[model samples]
Target: MPLSEQEQRLLDEMERHLLHNDADVVSAPSGDRTLSYRNLVYGALLLLAGVGALVAGVILGDVWGIVVGVIGFAAMLAGVMFAVTPVRRATPVTPREATSAKRQDSASFMDRMNDRWDRRQDGR
Candidate 1:
């Protein structure tokens, strides 16, 4: 069935209102939050290599070697941090959604049932 002219106008008005007032809701994976297992494995291997290089430098007791060893240790720290750190996933919160959530903070099942009953009574 087709909507009545008045209903169509109301729906169009509502669509316009929503388009103007509602924020764009997009769910996308940020590069930081998307950690692949392959990268993690590679990072772990890099960390191990870095630690070994540092240890070898220390054992050799050379100034240049020590510098290289420190560099390796820093690399190792970077790799380890990369491997251990988890991706932070966050959802973009819109003002309307925040307000609506706050408004319905404690709305329970019974509250919804009562609201439905009231609507039915009003409709009748």
Candidate 2:
């Protein structure tokens, strides 16, 4: 079932207002939240481990320690990249746009049918 033009416009307007309100709420930053002390301590431990690997590699002339250090560094870089990327949202289609798209689709379908009919006639 298709919506009438006026109903579609009302829906679109309501959607825009809701998105605007949501944008305002999300943009305000509250700074009361504190980082977990345990997590911070664990992060420091990981940093120390990386430094230890590098120092041990240089002191003992072991190439495998260097490889371990490189792998840890790569993992950290990948985590940062994943955190910064934004999630994409789907755009809502209005009734007018939907109708236009349907018309175009039907036009192409009719064209294909006409071509098939012409081919059948030629063959017969």
Candidate 3:
């Protein structure tokens, strides 16, 4: 359900107050839990290599074949582990904070302009 304008305003105000009072609330870091696409691809490659090695090992029936098969299986297991691990990312900067910064800069510029105007008027 969509929030009404008054509810939205209240939420915004509460957020501003909370952010002002709590630095952790504003700057808290977040973590990304999804595995990256690159990691997925790597995992797939490892699995395929392991399967191929195992198949070749069965067909060749040699010591080197068994060794290669074991290595490939280990690689595939490592890839699976990597793919399952959660990735960490920092919390995103809020649009409200950015807008506030821009407004402050504009206000400062306007104050300077007003000061200059007052100085000129006083001189005249």
lDDT of 2 by residue, 16-105 (tens): 444444645633323333334454555566656656665665665567867766755654554444444343334433436545544545
Question: What TM-score does prediction 3 earn?
Answer: 0.44
lDDT of 1 at 56: 84
Tell me, by TM-score, which candidate is best: 3
Worst 10 residues of 2 by lDDT: 26-35
| Candidate models: Cα lDDT each | 0.67, 0.55, 0.67
Give residue 81's lDDT in candidate 2 (0 to 100): 42
Tell me the TM-score of model 1: 0.40
Candidate 3 lDDT over 1-124, as tens digits, reads: 9999977865665565555557566554343443467777777787787778777777777898888778777877877876666565445446576657555455555575589799999995
Model 3 C-alpha lDDT versus the unseen true structure: 0.67
State in Å the error of residue 84, model 3. Answer: 1.5
lDDT of 1 by residue, 1-124 (tens): 9999977865655554454445353223333454557669978998998988898888878897888799889889989887866665454335465446434432443375578699999995
Which scores better on lDDT, 2 or 3?
A: 3
